[model samples]
Target: MDQFTLNLLVVGATFALYFGIAIWARAGTTSEFYTAGGGVHPVLNGMATGADWMSAASFISMAGIIAAGGYDTSAYLMGWTGGYVLLAMLLAPYLRKFGKFTVPEFIGDRFYSQSARLVAVICLIVASVTYVIGQMTGVGVAFSRFLEVKASTGLYIGAAVVFFYAVLGGMKGITYTQVAQYVVLIFAYTIPAVFISLQLTGNALPPLGLFSTHIESGMPLLAKLDQVVQELGFAKYTGHSDTTLNMFLFTMSLMIGTAGLPHVIVRFFTVPKVADARASAGWALVFIALLYTVAPAVGAMARLNLISNIYPNGTQSDPIAYEARPDWMRNWETTGLLKFEDKNGDGLIEFYNDKSKNEDFNAAAAAKGWAGNELTVNNDIMVLANPEIARLPGWVVALVAAGGLAAALSTAAGLLLAISSAISHDLIKGSLNPNISEKGELMAARVSMGVAIAVATYLGLNPPGFAAQTVALAFGLAAASIFPALMMGIFSKRINNVGAVAGMLSGLLVTVVYIFLHKGWFFIPDTNSYTDAAPLLLSIKSTSFGAVGALVNFAVAFAVSRATAAPPQAIQDLVEGIRIPRGAGKAQSH
Candidate 1:
């Protein structure tokens, strides 16, 4: 079969499977819609959460980014995985025990203030909407590549698919569908990696291959890769970055952000028991680690493949002719991710690092009639192009395309669900219309989901300037604004509504302002007062500012709580009640 038809058949089959699950598990009640009636078994919930947690960035972009940046990208791995530990330990069970449909409900009830809930809802919407843009845009890109549709058309189609199941099935539909997606995505991700590992190192497992000897070179795979790249004036495949402190901060920001993200946290609420929430988190991380460990191997192998492609005669020889470039390079060149300028007009690709710290090689390449690096490969394409680069079978390529869409859609559903709940459950039912019927609230929730999808798709088309960094920014906002408030609400019963609100505002504003100053004010390009590479406060890049924002939140909240009177004793009792595990299943029985 032709590649396109195979892609259609596989993708169509997976979509059919998900749609079937959505229909079978269609939500009938508000309870079903919001929390899947709190009946999800911990393991299945964990698998669903794993799907919801791993976004397009994780599935499609991580390996590519790691390939381009080398050891520096380890921050993403450590930070993201480490966060589940914090979430499982500090947040998940307690939030599930507090027992609300959304994060804001707990904040409002725990603080005994609708106003604090209002503030939390605002924070949730901001952080979630920012995150959704990336997912929607990712869906568009994945659709454009595999389905061969226009990017705009793909975005609308993807949105319609999500709305069909997500609006109907709610949490029930999404959770079950996400389980199917997890299977598809993980299979797609690991298969090619396993093949690449076997080809390069004679090892069946990718993570093990990363450290094993290269069958051809006789040296460890990573060491051989480093030796070749460094010989070509590129940084070592596993070298540390110049900005060690910034990497630390960035990793910390992602860790805190991961724990704080509302969509991820909400997954715990679907399970029946507080113990289930804790156990589910462990399972979720176990599922998540499978892909996380494979990613570095993928990155390292892909990088070696590309460099070897350009220098078929080894790094000591002239480059391959431009006309002889393979199908993968040719196809990506059409999308402009892979480009060559024919520097020196040699008609051969001159691929090397233009800004290497080693000046001797820079001068040597120039002396060798190499007029600087002519190949401009976008970092994003490495993973998507990895299969073709390795001459893998077409079915594997199709699977990868399907996997990318599955990843994007899963996370998009989770984010939209979080946003919709904040609207219907928090703002409408909890505040404006406390007397609204369950059926009416469910209707409102569906309506809100549709609106959220439309808004996300629109922003994807004309994304705010910050959309490129939306994932990181989303995490930062959550880390600073949401995480601290939830922590203080549980750990410190004395934190009044005023203190919680004050802390959230302070953290949120400072984080946003710092990002804007570095990225752009309101994300307008070139409007930044300070670039990340330029000097900024405390020698921290804006990308790494979330941890700092979270600290500010803690300090301000504690200081304000100290200066003011303690929360009333009734609220104190509520806190103590939540601290125990016996009655959490009925926390919302009121």
Candidate 2:
């Protein structure tokens, strides 16, 4: 069968399965919609959480970022993995025991203020909407290439698919659908890695293959990769280029951000008991480790494969003529993601770092009469195009297409659910209309989700950065605003309503303003005063500012709380009750 037909068949089958699950597990009440009826098995919930957690950024864009940035980009892998651990241990079980329907709900009740809940709803929407934009971007990239549609058109179609299942089944459908998505995505991710690993290093397991010798070069795989990239003016594959401070803050942001994300935290609420929540988190870590470990191998192998294809001999030799470029290049070029322009008007395509500081490489390029880098490859395309770049089988490529879609759609559903629940549950029922009927609230949830999907699709067309970078910004916002509030609510009895509100607003405002100054106001193109290359702060990019925002939140909360009256005695007792290990299991029963 042709590649397009194979892609359609595989991707269509997965969509069909998602719809089937949605219908079979359709939610009937607010409880089912919000928390999947609170009866999902721990292992099953963990698998579903794995799918929910690994969005388009993780599946489609992370490896691409790693491939281009090398060691500096490992922060994405480290931060996300560590953040999941932090979320699972520091927050998940406690939140689940509290038995709130949403993050804002927990915050509102814990702080004993309706104003706190409303502020949390705002924070949840801001972070989740930003996150959905990244997922939609991935959907566009995957669809534009495989489905042979314009990126905007792909986003519209993806929105339609998400609307059907997400609006119909709510969390109940999303949870089960995500479990199936996990299976498809993991198989799709690991199979390509296995094939490429064997092809490059004669090792079947990708993690081991990463450290194994390159079959043809007889050198350690990373050592060979570093030599090749450095020869072409790129940084060493294992060398750090970003500052230690920025890396440290970036990692911390992602870690705490994971804990704060309403979509991820809500997953814990789907389990039957507090212990089940903990068990599910452990299982999720194991499942997440599967893809996270293979990602580095895939990135390294694909980078090598890509450069090897372009420089058939070596970087010093003449590159392949533009007309002689491989089929993969032609296919990706159609999507406008991989492009070649002959700046020197030479027939050959030169793919190298144009801004390299290497004098010897510059002199060599000057002697060769090279003008500048001619090939522009988008980082988001690296993983999606990896199987094709490596000349893998058509089926493997098709599987990847399905896997990428599954990853994007699964996370989009989760984020939209968080957004919708925040609106309908926290804002409408909890605040605006406390007497709202269950049926009315359910309709509001669906409508809110539909609106969120429309907004997400619109923003996806004009994303501020690549998928992973956009997602990182979302993480930063969550870390700054929501995480500090949740932590203080659960751990500290002195954090009154005024303090919680002050901290969330202060953290969110600072981070948003910092990002806008560098990334443009609301991410509009060419409207920014500064760029990440020369950030307003000292070596602190907007993406790294979340950790700083989080610190500001904690400081402000403490200062404000100490200057004001203490939390009510009942509130203090409530906080104490949630923290006590012995009574934690009984609280779930209450």
Q: Candidate 2 — what's its lDDT?
A: 0.91
Predicted structure 2, TM vs. truth? 0.97
Lowest summed lDDT window (length 10), candidate 1: 526-535
Stretches of model 1 off by over 4 angstroms after superposition: 149-153, 462-469, 521-535, 586-590
Spell out the clash pairs found in candidate 2: 83-255
**The 10-residue segment with the lowest total lDDT in model 2:** 581-590
Tell me the TM-score of model 1.
Answer: 0.94
Total clashing pairs in model 2: 1
Reference-based lDDT, each prediction: 0.84, 0.91
Give residue 515's error in model 2 in angstroms. 0.9
Candidate 1 CA-lDDT value: 0.84
Model 2 agreement with the true structure over 1-590: per-residue lDDT tens digits: 99999999999999999999999999998888988988899999999999999999999999999998888999999999999999998898888778778999889889999999999999999999999999999999998888876777788888899999999999999999999999999999999999999998899999999999999889999999999898888888899989999999999999899889999999988987888989999999999999999999988988999999998886546689999999999988878878898998889988888789898888888888888999989889899899999999999999999999999999999999999999998889988898999999999999999999999999898887889999999999999999999999999999999999999999999999998886756556552122354667888888888999999999999999999999999999989887753333321211
Q: How do all models score by TM-score?
A: 0.94, 0.97
